[model samples]
Target chain A: MAASDAEAPGMRPWILMSPALGAVVLLLAIPICFILVYSFWLRSAVGSEQVGFHLDNWVEVLTDRFYRDILLQTLRIAAISALLCILLGYVPAYFIARSTTRHKTVLILLLMLPFWISYIIRTMSWINILGVSGALNVFLLWTGAISEPLQILYNEGTVILGLVHFLLPFMILNIYVSLDGIDPNLVDAARSLGATGWQAFLQITLPLSLPGLAAGSLLCFVLGAGTYITPMVLGGPRDAMFANLVFEAIITQLDWPLGSALSLALLVILGSVVMLYTRFAGIGQLAKSFR
Target chain B: MDETTRYQRLLERFRNGDLERRTFLTLLGAASLGAGLTGGPLKGLQRQALAATPESVRFDGWGGVVSEAFRKYAFDPYTKNTGITVIDGTFASGDEYLNRVKAGQEGEYNIFHASGVFDYARYVNLGYDVVLNEDNIPNLQYVMTALMEPFRGVTGGKLSAAPYDYGTTGLAYNTEKISKEEMEQKGARILIDPEYKGKIGGSGDWRTRIWYGALATDQDPNDIKDMDAVWDAIRAHRDLALKYWGSGAELMSLLAEGEIYVTEGWSGRIAALQQQGHPIGYYDAPNGYAWQECLMVLKGSPLEACEELLNFMLEPDVAIAVAEGQNYPPSLDPTKVDLGEKIPELPAFDPTGKLAGLTFASPAYWNGNEAEWSKTFGRVQKGY
Candidate 1:
């Protein structure tokens, strides 16, 4: 019976893992390999794909100063967006975590409210609010807040605002779950030992919630980096993101090989950042915090 | 023994004497009968199957009142008449829709409403369009000669598209912002007038901006194809430019907001805005504007059905309805429609008319030098 029990545990884990392993290999690994292979192909003169191994695409990306500048700009915008999400999300998440059961449920629902609507609708709603002749401007003009309409619709500031509005719920939910998982007894114990409220929070609660913060930051950063629609709708031509460039390369120019190379470059950058976060911060703990 | 042997001998004689030929004849007769029975039923099944499957036509082009009118008149009528469905895939810009076709989703759409400038030789080379049969369309004879001649394919033996509607890209402005006296005094040269600096809204289209710059300086647009002249003119008038709008909708919006006193826009869209109570007015400049827009059928369609639809679209009443509905001038003769107050007076395409000399957008100019031109424009326009 004891020997059978040991075998059962081993068999159970393998049984549970098979579907997940199969899904990852089929959906993720295979497509990624295809993209990697295509990245080495060449683009034809007329912007069509030529099926041959060449380093020209990679070299172009590496040598072109415009591409490099855009890449750096994308990274900077993504980082700023992620940092903003963290700042805006923390207070609400903390409040929700410390709230009573009913309040906590309401707060969680409020965080998820925007997700009920389509992402496109939510993004476009900003246009209605911020356009020169739109609702907000009309109201402001009626109240005599300003003489002329404010130029707020198409710019970097509005793009970041849209990103934050889209991504804040994920950050808050992740952080809230992490805070909820912390034992109340530990906090009481810390306070009972004469530690001040700030000290208790700094040494205990903050450290405990680090996993959630890391997870939320990773989610926000990757999403912001890969965002296309928000930036396209709200941003000017100069504010084109890396994803938009990839889209234009493949769809507009019909240069699939170059698009593959650019996509892989983005994936590698995002992967390295994730790996770095996992090294110092525990990815498993971060994932668990979301639950 | 004697009786059994006699019976067997008689049967063997019957089997050996051309019996195989007789049996083959009988089988052939039966096969023919079976085919005769099933042929009509098979055709019925095919018709039913086609009926069960929804026949859908997709219209891809710029979105606004024009697209809305197409949805109402062309798409809806086509669907109602043929029991087919219509899909309205409205694009914000022509370049974006062209990109979609380039991405090899051309076959997915049944029809494309493209501007002549946007759909070029590359599309033809890629086999993205179908040749239209003039015989199938009785109304083909009524299309304006100039509008019909250009799309008559490489051999001039076939047409790749039918003339839907034609309009010139011209100037749209707020009459409230820019006085009529000033416009009359300045004429086409108002764009370059140094006194009215920082009060103009130009389109983001490279061709329109370049041509406007050339015409403003009293230079022939066709001769000013060089990037140097284009950039120089833009820089000289940079102080006068308020913004560069990417679409007619954006131009109208800017005009409504009073941010732009005068700007480049389509006459139809400006007319639509005026009808909707916006303070926008349009003018055909003396140096002339660009004529654009065409209706092309997708390749690999049911040719007979598409031909029928094309013919239906070109009917005099249909043409008038489409023109009146979309705010574009009908390509058919003016006598076809009763000139009510609802229809705005549009300039005639006659050579002697005030808006006689018009240039169409050419793909060659942008396709070859977009990067350089965009860079120059970016520098001079200061990134609008």
Candidate 2:
């Protein structure tokens, strides 16, 4: 239609997309805006929340040393998990991208199989394998590998492992999509010019696949940062994350205003990470990864 | 169609002139009233309608088997006796259910197992609680004295809730791992017990953790407002704990799998685990953590039917059935309940006459300073 009528208003095309756009605004924007408003409301002494504007909740979130630590810890965990996902996911993704089309379908299916089950069930399975009397311990004892059971579950390390385990597939799929788009001859050209395998990959395939790497790492980072269950179930006391604090404020403590403030603070932190990444990698580049 | 309904007989008698028009009208008005104002002739009709009326009462309860047990013991039988079918809904937390009711979204559920006794205070403060009609709940006479009393005494003061089930929270151990005698000596202080290093477990409920620290330190749990003292105590005992758990199921899994030798838990959950064939045993510590779980009807709810439901739960047989189903100590009068076999340790565990002995955490006391509590406790749990 636009090709036929060059003078047509851009609004006509947007009208066609309005239904999807309306849903995004309704489900995402309206709720986030509401949370932004509630962030200023006050929580009363008796655990009842009222609609009054105040900065106390914000001050508590931003100023308090504890909230600061939790926020920083959340960022730290997400960054590490995303970095690990990139490292772990890149190999399988590259191999899958290099496979025959018939094999690629089976490989991708196998990669996505674990996700068919619930996320919580997958996390609990880790508990069964990692806990003191869990499968790992029983196996180790049966093999006479150690005199005592190892306390592997409920620690910072286990929390990271859980996050990476949940997120590895997403990272793999994203990287594979970008890697699969590359022309196979580009790397062969470098190899014919006497470039080593590592050098050819570093110069050609890696640069081309940067879009997928950025997209997958960003996805992993966002999910890892926002996760509530993995750490809560597998990690010890110190493993409590920003989501848990938000959970307590709204659900347990009945302090919606404070919870809303905490939620917005988390969104700001996560949003800024995306924005900063976009500044360097460009949003257009990352969006093209999905294509 | 075989014998027609009571209304049919009334109509036949009226048409035959055996019944006066005034009498017929009065009878008709009373019959239509049903169980609305639950006293007098209307109630007798309700007893007749108990098997087939379309009227149904809904209960929002904690989910999983606990909700099923509530249906089997209290709800299902009540429906069978009275035609009012019981509709069941499940909730995860008290604040969640209260918020739903407060928002006017849950018009369907009148009677709710809203958290513990502490939450009852919040309900009253929030004006969500209805003044219970003790006349309708005659069997409240059999309710435990401590729960029935004025504001939860032996009796007489603005009763708003029917205390159903309560359990003790304190140090428990795998009997195969340690004797009760050894556990008692450690008591709540067992959190810091060196012998159980990396073997202790508890959920991350600040109130119970505070009570644990208070009991261990010989301080009144309810009296303390700030968790500074609570956390300091827990920090000292931090080494004994594995990690602060987030859910009962998580802690139970730890216990059931023998991941931990000593467990910090609630008696309700311990009972659940024991039924699953775990050798779980609670230490009868002198100072313990206890909360009375009550069923509260929301204000402006159908009071007549709600009160009757509460009263039915108080009956000796019904109370025992509930007690057996949940494996929690009956909140009704202990004398009325037969605790012969289902849960022998319940009576010994719950302090019917000596509620004062246990550290009762007040809702008012618990709500204050949660942010600070979590902040301090978070650091403490990390051994900071």
Candidate 3:
């Protein structure tokens, strides 16, 4: 009876998990399998897909200098954007975590307000702020700061700026979670031992927050690398990311095989990043940020 | 054989006393069970047994004033008359829209406001087209033969789309910055001019880029022998361009804000800007890019409902109203229909109805090279 009871518990967990396992298999794994199969097919001259096993798409993706350069550029942009997010995000997060204010929930709620607006709208809002006749230029011209409006909207810098805007809250929230988890007594203990406030923070608080910072960086890098819209909306002709190439392949060129290959390439790279992060930072810290 | 023929054969066999009563009954029951389980004709029967009328039909189009006009003049009135809902959707570009339609199920996308004969040919080749009964859409007679003929030629004399409007991708310049004489003199070459560097914008569309490139190189767009020179011209334009605007709204915004001094612009969008009192001057260069828009009924659509909607949209009052509202000239031949005053004043207005003056891309030529040129253009546009 005891052996049967033990087996029942094991089977109960599996039964309980079956729906989620089924969902993952049906929604995620199956679609990826389809994409993998499509990557081997050939696109006909007439734009319809030719069903066959072919290595042409994979060969081009792996060997082409164009794809390599675009992929490298995407990684570079994503790294810069993530680093910028860290530098800009840590201060507000520290303040919020160490705050003695009563309306802390309100502050956090305000931080989440940007999520209420569409991401595309938020990306596009930069055009109104940074365009030649936009608010910044208008304000600058009104103050006689410059004789002419600065042409500032469509460029690589603006694309990064848009990414940072979209990703800042995520960084702040993750870092804040890390900061909040550190015991206040640790800083007090350091301070009591003749350490300055700065020394206490550097020695105690910053070290504890490293995991959340890494998690936020991972999230930001993966998202920034995968973005197509920001560059399409606020970027110059030369500021396209890796995702835009996939878009051009599938939509403009009607080459689904090439697009599928390119997309899988991106997925593998980003997935490797996540796996590496998991190896060091115990992926559980990523979930703590949401809570 | 069909279910009816099989049933009749079974009945005849039984009446001829070729089978016992119990054996006949067993065979009939087995046939019924097989038909129920295996479907085939039963699926058709099930569909026929369902609703005779569809609840709603979907129509996708370019947004902004175009959608507004259709809503106010065409779809809204059609819905009011027929007691059916029109689900209006918007697409940023034809390529993006085609990708979406390809990914979706048949009948999910009932109609599309498609651009150009090449796009029609692409759809036909992709097998997304549906034949419309001409007798139902009686108002198709008023459309210009010039506009209709190209689409017909693409589909081998059967149209999957009704030509609705026509426009040109002409050079739009900031009038305050560039003189009309300079624009006319420079023509397509102005986009590649060194002085206009960092002050020019162009459509991000591959076809528009290639079309302008061909013109800049003094080659016919329909038949380009030296593609290297055209590519060089495109490279020059790319280096000089400030931005590649994606939508009509962005094109107007760029010209209106003076961010770009010169770029290829849509005739109707430029007209809209001019009407808004922006200092934008539109001049179609010699051998300029001209194209027509069509309302295409996709396969698996409820044919009668979509036909009714097309007929309503093609009416003189609705077409003229939409034309004036969106600033594109209607497909109605001015020689046949009195298209009122505003359409006559619109950009790319074809009073002659022959459209002999405007040059259009040959579907065979463009669609034939779509797989290669479109992919190559993607690389070239990004500093290749």
Which candidate number would show the highest TM-score if scored against the true structure? 3
DockQ of each: 0.31, 0.36, 0.84
Question: Which runs in model 1 stand beyond 4 Å of their true positions?
Answer: A1-47, A134-145, A251-254, B1-92, B102-107, B117-120, B153-157, B180-225, B229-248, B259-262, B286-289, B335-341, B344-356, B363-384
> TM-score of B chain for each model?
0.74, 0.75, 0.87
Question: Native contacts recovered by candidate 3, as a share?
Answer: 0.91
Q: Can you tell me which runs of candidate 3 are displaced by over 4 Å?
A: A1-4, A282-291, B1-52
For residues A126-244, what per-residue lDDT tens digits would candidate 3 score against the true structure? 88899898999999999999999998978899999999999999999989988988889999999999999999989898888988898899989999999999999989989999999
lDDT of 3 by residue, B1-384 (tens): 865566567667878998787887676666545655876554332222111335788999988777888899889999899988999999988988999988865566888999998999999999888788888999999988889989888777888899999999999999999999999999999999999889999999999999999999999999998999999999999888889998888898888988999999999999989899999999998899999999999876888888989999999988998888888999999999998878899888878999999999999999999888988899999999
CAPRI band for model 1: acceptable
Candidates in order: C-alpha RMSD to true structure: 10.7, 7.9, 5.3
Q: What do the candidate models score in CA lDDT, each in turn?
A: 0.69, 0.75, 0.89
Cα deviation of A170 in candidate 3 (Å)? 0.5
TM-score on B-chain, cand. 3: 0.87
Pairs with backbone N, CA or C atoms under 3 Å apart (clashes), candidate 3: none
Give lDDT: candidate 2, residue A145.
Answer: 100
DockQ of 2: 0.36
lDDT of 1 by residue, B222-305 (tens): 566555665666766655665557666666776776656787777777777887898777777776666656667766455556
